[model samples]
Target: MRSVALDLGVHEISFCEVAGGAVVLRRTVRSLDSLEDLLGPSSSPARVAIEACREAWAVHDTLRNWGHDVLVVDTTRARQLGIGQHGRKNDRLDAEALAHAVERGGIPLAHVLSPHRRAIRHQLAVRRALVETRAQYVTTVRGILRACGHKLARCTTEGFLTVLSAAALPAETRQLVGPLVTALEMLTPQIALADAALEQLCTHEPVIVRLTTAPGVGLVIAAAFVSVVDEAKRFHHAHQLASYLGLVPSEDTSGGRNKQRLGAITKQGNAYLRVLLTQAAHTILRHKSGDDPLRQWANAIDERRGRHVAVVALARRLSGVLWAMWRDGTVYDAQSAAVASAKGLRLQAQSIEQQAQSMKEASVKARRRQRSIDKGLGATRATARSRPVSTSRRASMH
Candidate 1:
């Protein structure tokens, strides 16, 4: 079978065909129509390699429809395959590299998400952008007012207009800030609409509904998790899911040494999902009661470590817990969490008590050793004194 590597660009596509360990065809096509024309109708299907990019999925779908086997490789891994190492890097070189990689086999393939999951991801991304833009405008308004010596009170996005209206601002200042205020006003409604749409989407999703049962998880977080994860079965275990989300710590090991020093999270996966999980963890820690096992565990960690460490740990734990819930088709179990928390607390108490007892025994042993040394010195001095006077008297008589 032949292999075709395609380096896709906005305006053109550079491609190469390899058959029987030789470059059989190399060309540049200006459009999809031209590409089809060049390939022509053929009975034998060639393996097509496309690096995962913005247009990769669309291209993959098109090629698949054309009856060709498509392999979408991750861009990062494709680069690491020594593509364009010696000469000037260009589309042709990249295409050649991809072709050779395909022939070599073992190319890392990118997971193409389902259309439903992609739609949800798109909606979430749009909503996040709108919210961020609104926040930027809000900050700008606050800064402008502060500069003019008319500071407005901090208010929610919905209440910002009222706050701005009540603030006694100079006419010139108001004129300058009016446009930004209008922009914020426009953005607020759009954001609300997006939120409403997202809420409706979440309400229909059983996964999101089950996720929301966990403490600190609400509609937004649950939806975000569902959108990003797509499928719970992708992960074989809860820890694997956490690791995929980059919630786990990184490892640095050397020859024969099994030193596991935990550092900051890798933060390699979806940034938005990680942020939502962290926010949920923070909410749980701040507002949840001790009666809940997860809350109790978090509080214990917060007391031992600082709030920041506790929050990150809780976030990682939350990922694991959510994955477990999803995989098992079970809701959050507060009672079980509470029981585990109690058991952990008991073990901690016992460890502390054992440590204190060991310290006390060591202190007593040290005191006894000191007393024994002192007695030995005193006895030696008394013997010397008792024998010394007779020796001195005998010497004087002689």
Candidate 2:
């Protein structure tokens, strides 16, 4: 069997083919149309490996369609393969390294998202960009007003325009901030349209609907989770899902001691998903009633470790909880969460009680052993006094 590696570029692709024990083919192809010619034939499928990039999914899909086993390697992991360690870093070297990696099974493959999920992910990205642009414009407008000893009142997006229009400002200040306000006004409608489209998309997704049943998870957050996760079955447990979202604590241990130093999250996976979950956590903590089990759990954590820590913890827990709900095909239930909490508490209490009882029994045994030892010593002394000194001692005394 032969393996091929492609160093894909915007306008060109460098490929290397390995057969038996050496490089059989190494060349650069200018267009995707010529890729088939390089591959020889469609009947003889070859293992193809490529570093994951913006165009990776497209290339992978194309090659797969042509009967090639395409493996998209993670970009970061591919860089660590020591391809350019000697300074002669070029497309040919990279292609050869990738081909060798594929042959030796050293490449870490990336998850290939389905078309629908990829589309949703892209739409969410677009929405995030629009929202961020709008925020930037708003901040610029505020900064300009503040520089002139004026402060705009806190208001909604639509209200912001009204406030700008009615502000009693000098002509120069107005002119200076006019373009920013106009940009903001233009961004507002685009953001609203994106929100509306997201809402429509989420409305049609049953998984998103189930996710929304979780407190603090509205349409946007739910949709983001569904799109980012794609397949719930990918994670065997909630912990894995949470870890994938970079919500879990990082572990750093050595010298036979397994210590997990609580620090910032790993932030390894989709950053957008992490942000959405954190925002959802904030909403859950702020608006949810204390009586709610999830809220109570968060409140308990807040009491122990400040509010900010509680929010992050809640976010991490929320990721796991939502994943569990999705995996089990069940809706989030407040009562069930409460029951689980109570059961955990009961088990903890039982464990403490059993430990205390064992300690007490051990203490009693120690006391009995000490008493027996003391009694034996006293009996020995009595016998020694009653029988008098030994014959050798008596003779020495005489």
Candidate 3:
């Protein structure tokens, strides 16, 4: 049996091959594309195995395309079964160990991500990184401005630089801020171009289209969700997706009893996806209309417990909703959600009604103010007319 493994590193990818449990080939692949030359044409089908890494999916896809039966193993289990415990850790041992582990079935196998999916996800990952980097720079610039007692307006619709540049900043502060403004100016065009690329990607992606069906999930959130999960079928239920996203409550159970504590999210898996989901949840809470069952549940919890807890709870629910929609291809329906989750739905409607009432009152007050202003203006005009402008003396005399 000819087997191969790649010792994945940030800067370098080392390759090792084993035949009949003996080291026969060793080479470092500079990039994923270089793997083609290493695997020679064998008379029979070859069994290849490699530890799951950031680059594992791409590499796995490439190997599979070359007509090899590739096994992607969980790195943790592979570590437990082989050379990880040994004093010396190197490419040679890791490759052999992966081969042995695969032959023995000691490690759980990883799914080979399709090239199409990998390409789509790669685009999403790049977009995500750029967005986060842009946010970091914006925060840094804002901090500098705030430190000097100059406030920047919060407006993401316009580019960060546009907002900052339009500010009436001190000349000295502007001098210090010029480079940051210029950097943001540069990033803005790149971010727009990236967003257009992502949108084009979304046009053909069914999963993204399904994810975006939920009320508040935009293209960015949908892309992030799809990139992270890859396959919703992998998870059985919404709770599974929630747990995967670290949206579920952490449990403390002992002595045959389980205790629930209110703490920050465990934040265990796919932090980026969780943030996107939570942000989407917050948007729904703020802007969504109608009798949403999930919204009702959140408001009730907020009233009984607190706003923070409610928001988290809602976020968890949102995860399940996303999963259900993705898994079943069902569109969102208020009546259906309310029927299924009556208590949560009722509470959401109540909250919306309350907001509606406040708006209604504000509208009434504005109308009354307008009427009063109109009445006062009319009286002033009548008085001016009654106070008679002096007639021209020549006309009166004629």
Best by TM-score: 2
Q: Estimate each model's TM-score.
A: 0.78, 0.79, 0.73
Cα lDDT, model 2, residue 13: 90
Give the per-residue lDDT digits (tens) of candidate 2, residues 1-398: 56889998888899899876489888897866677876645547889998888898888888878878898988757667657867778888899988888788767888888887777778888889987887778788888889889998889754577788888899999889878876775666566566656655655667776676677876678778989888887877667777788877777665677664566778889898899999988988899887878788889999998898888888887887777667766666666567653111111122455445534543453355345445434544554477767899999999
Sum up the clashes in candidate 3: 3
Check candidate 2 and list the clashing pairs: none
Relative to the true structure, candidate 2 has a C-alpha RMSD (angstroms) of: 31.2
lDDT of each: 0.75, 0.75, 0.67
Predicted candidate 1 versus true structure: per-residue lDDT over 1-398, tens digit per residue: 67889999888999898766678789898866678854545436778898888788788888878788889987656657667687668898889888887787888887787677677778899889988898888888898888888888878865787788988888999899889986775666566567656655655577776676678886678778888788887877667777778888887665767776768888877899999999988998888776877777888989998898888888887887777667766566665445533111111122455445534543453355345434434544554576546787889989
For TM-score, candidate 1 versus 3, the one ahead is 1
Better of 1 and 3 by lDDT: 1
Clashing pairs in 3: 293-345, 296-347, 296-348
Best-to-worst order by lDDT is 2, 1, 3
Model 3 agreement with the true structure over 1-398: per-residue lDDT tens digits: 55566677777677776666667777776676676566544334567777778777776766776777778776545657576655767776676677666566556775555556666677877867766777888888889999999888778733466577689988999999778666665555565556666667766776665565566776678777776777878976667777767877776665666555445667877777777877877887898774677687677898998877888787787777766656665544455455554122221232455445534543453355345445434544555566655679547877
Off by over 4 Å in 3: 1-3, 10-38, 42-44, 76-80, 86-89, 157-163, 251-265, 339-398
Worst 10 residues of 3 by lDDT: 341-350
